[model samples]
Target: MIPSLRLLYWRPSAAALVRTRALLPMAEFYNHETGDGAFRLIQKSDYARALQGARVGLCLSDHEGPMRASVEYQLLDLPVVTTEAQGGRIEMMDPAHCRVVPADPRAVADAVQELAAEEIPAGAVRASVLSRLAAHRAALPGLIRPHLQAAFDDASAGVTLDDIGKVDLWRTRDAEVIRREVDAMPV
Candidate 1:
């Protein structure tokens, strides 16, 4: 049986068209275009409902920050086929539930086929996201504490309000200054 696929396009950009064209020959293409301008926005509930019968979610973007849609796909119990350059998504997904492939369309097609043949439990996929979220929450304070301390120390230092007024905020807030401050913090 042919596996069901759901392609979620947030904006009607050239990128979306490229992805759709790449996958069209591999499977039957369906167009559900709505809305106007570049955006084809859908409600979260509607998106989730649309994913109900999908066997896999495809994220074919060349780059992504966190790949929020892929995470949503996992939450809705759909396996994800994403690109490796998808930022935090690589770290968020478990290998069992997510396939990180190259940007090549063939690679994406192969991953989809592989995932379609296997049975991935929905609860396990959702649990992977929850576990990552819990770990991130637990570690957030530690990651942020040093920066907060550095900012506090800077505020209390010999620099007076008058001196602060004279100083260029942009230059003072450069990456090198921040890096030096972070590096100086005690482990």
Candidate 2:
């Protein structure tokens, strides 16, 4: 029996648009198509649930992201076949974890076929997710510290106006006059 090789994506475009018919008999194309068809859009909440008992998660895009669904699949320990154009800061499905292939339907088909024939090692899939999580976990502080400091400084110190040269005098004076007049006016 062929294992479940499902495409979990937010939108269908590019090769996905074409592969719907190309991979129709084999791949279960999911995501927003109705009327007596195997392909159907699953709600975001139900993504992980829908992936239950699935073997492969396929995403074939010229420009793909390090997607949440892909990560979820990784967390669920499912093999993935995706293009290089994924969005995440880190490659969640590294070469060790999943099949990274050319952004073409045939290549995607081959990867899916390979995954279906051979079971994806649970350790590898989990480790890929864990590795990405660990890297992000380790880097979280560094990633946030600089931005937080910049924000803190901006909030606390603000943009100083010593000479007031940068300020548009008309707008500034208008605001100042309004404030002074409001303050000086009878309560």
Candidate 3:
């Protein structure tokens, strides 16, 4: 943890670990337990308020599914210090406002400090996410058009594998599988 920084750990489980293990000593060293200094324990529900007050958001989990919290933080225009383990968060994050580091506290703290020192515009961060989402939405039809066309043509012709072009063979197999599954279902 950075000496000048105040970190709020929002996960109850992480607080429990700090209380039960060798981490407690480290927390004490940082004056985390006294609630008077560099570290504090907070509830997840307070995230919106916390992000508003905080200079950086930290996502340190080594394993995660979607990490919506990190995205929310970015949407709120806060810079994020995330572990490399972040899966979905990495995709939407702008490098100027986000740093992907190892799961070490020192690295996280350093990233936080670095980001804090920079002049990242909150509107830019929010715009990056919005633009990415809009691009994805715009591309949705392109992604599904071929499949929809294949389905429509297949329904009309009662498609056979031989009738499908090489590029669309996967769709032909998928249609066959669906047909087999439907035919096997009871009336």
Which lDDT values do the candidates have, in the order given?
0.69, 0.62, 0.66
Better of 1 and 2 by lDDT: 1
Q: Candidate 1: lDDT of 62? A: 73
Which has the better lDDT: candidate 1, or candidate 3?
1
- In the range 1-187, model 2's lDDT, one tens digit per residue, is 3344555555566676677658566655555433244446676667777788777776555564445767777777878787667466236667654787887767887887788668556578877788778877666545334433454554423333322235532254467755775467442
Would you list the rank order by lDDT, best first? 1, 3, 2
Stretches of candidate 2 off by over 4 Å are 1-8, 11-41, 153-187
> After superposition, which runs of candidate 3 have C-alpha atoms over 4 Å from their true positions?
3-47, 146-187
lDDT of 3 by residue, 55-151 (tens): 7777878788667767787778888889998356777788988999998878888898999899986588888878876776666545444554666
lDDT top scorer: 1
Local error of candidate 1 at residue 176 (angstroms) = 14
- The 10 consecutive residues of candidate 3 with the worst lDDT sum are 24-33
Query: Who wins the TM-score comparison?
Result: 1
